[model samples]
Target: MTNVLILGAHGQIARLATSQLLQETDHHLRLFLRQPERLTITDQAREEVVDGDVLDSAALTKAMAGIDVVYANLGNAKIEAQAKSVVAAMTKAGVKRLIWISTLGIYDEVPGAFGQWNHQMLDGGYLETYAAAAKVIEQSGLAYTIIRPAWLSNADTVSYELTQKGEPFKGTEVSRKSIADLVVKLINDPQQHIGESLGVNQPGTDGDKPSFY
Candidate 1:
């Protein structure tokens, strides 16, 4: 069982991923979040809840100590700083593997219908922000897997396909559960995705067309 640390544990994707990890896997989890009370975890004995913000380097350093891997599902805003702190903390703690959640079009790789819509929804360097973060991770000397999911959906069901580097994004929307599952998969076997950025999305879907009127 891997000793995994999940940053941004209160976020939607993080919550779902935690649920799956708890129910399906034997791995131990340390949930790092700003508000521990808001977490819906039932197995108190199985999870170590660290109430702190990612921006707090000291707290993060403390939380990351002695962990095997880190799964980051941080939001886009302030991602650069947050990632930097995580890297520093992990480095200090001697944790190496990092699984980071990003969005499609971070490299203008979004393809099909979804890519077009994502471009419109996320304007003004939203793509650039994540791309920059990925760039940092790539160069941080850490074994990392960057997952860029298509426009996220709250649907209860999840189905997805994985696209590796150089492949254009395909598909439409992805359930938060699906994203969570992917994270778990990585945690289960880090060797499969070390140092690679992959894309996930619903198949046969396209971007939401904009109205010119």
Candidate 2:
């Protein structure tokens, strides 16, 4: 079975992906997070839990050892440093595959007024760091697929669209379950979208802003 390391294991998207992985594949899971007790499932026949910060390379190295794939579902703010740490640890562990969860608008991929709003709202803060993290993964020489999801909701649908890198990012929102569906697809078939940074959104949700915003 493929051994996967999931950093930021307690994050909402990561948690959903974990559930999808558990239900859909027999892959072994290595869950790493700051608070071990926060994760809903601490022990399963095929799961291992490790407690530590994602910015800690030593901890990441230990967590990454013998891992076949790394799923980094980190948050913004310190994401650039976290990306660096994750890449370093993966290199140290000789792990070559990574699935990084980033947001749209970092590459100026978003279009129209939504793009304008996105830039004015996030460019200096989360967008800046998100771009930096994306650069790290692209330069790491690892087989990577960066997923840039639009504003996420806690919806349960699995339907979505993918705007391949270089395409104008379409739509303004996607369900968390859709992101998990795509992530699990990539985990099950790593050869599909290598070196691509994909923008994921629900097919008909394009707008100037997310519905809730």
Candidate 3:
């Protein structure tokens, strides 16, 4: 069974992905979170939780040991530093695959009215930080898949179409569940999405704008 490390394990999307992974795959889960006490999972059969800040490389390396794939659901702010730490830890631990979650408008990939609003809402240091993190992953010489979802929602179900880099954002909003599902799929089939940065959103819906606005 594949051994996967999940960063920010207590976050909503990460929690959903953890649940799905436990149900759908035989993979072993290593959960890296700042606050491990917040996670309330009854099943302890195939899961290990490590409490540590994302910026702590030694801690991350300790948690990442023997891990084959890493799912990064870290938030913004010091995301660039966190990504650097993760890359360093993964390299030291020989973990070659990473599925990282970024957001729309990081590279101005979204277009038209929604794109404009996205820029307005997510602009400034955070966007730059995410972009820097993306660049680090792109140049890390490791197999990586960057999943950038549009404005996120707490919808209950999973359903969305993913567009690769250079395509317009599919829609203004995608359920967190959908993003989680996609992350899980990528984890299960790492070879298909390696070195690709994808944009995900609910499909076939027009005239709806980015949820940030």
- The estimated TM-scores of all candidates read 0.92, 0.97, 0.95
- Which ten contiguous residues of candidate 1 have the minimum total lDDT? 204-213
- Model 2 ranges with Cα > 4 A deviation: none
lDDT of 3 by residue, 1-213 (tens): 889899999989999999999989999998889868999875688899898998887888899888888999997688888888888988998889999998887778887877777777778887788988999988898899999987888878787988888877778888999999998888888887889999988875444475444
- Between candidates 1 and 2, the one scoring higher on TM-score is 2
Specify the highest-lDDT model's number: 2
Tally clashing residue pairs in candidate 1.
4
- Winner of 2 and 3 under TM-score: 2
Residue 93 error for model 3, in Å? 1.0
TM-score, prediction 3: 0.95
- Sliding window of 10 residues with minimal summed lDDT for model 3: 204-213
Which candidate has the top score in TM-score? 2
TM-score of 2: 0.97
Per-residue C-alpha lDDT of model 2 across residues 36-142, encoded as one tens digit per residue? 89877744887889989987778789888888889998986899999999989999889999999999987998999999998988866889999989999999999
Can you give the lDDT of residue 203 in candidate 2? Answer: 88
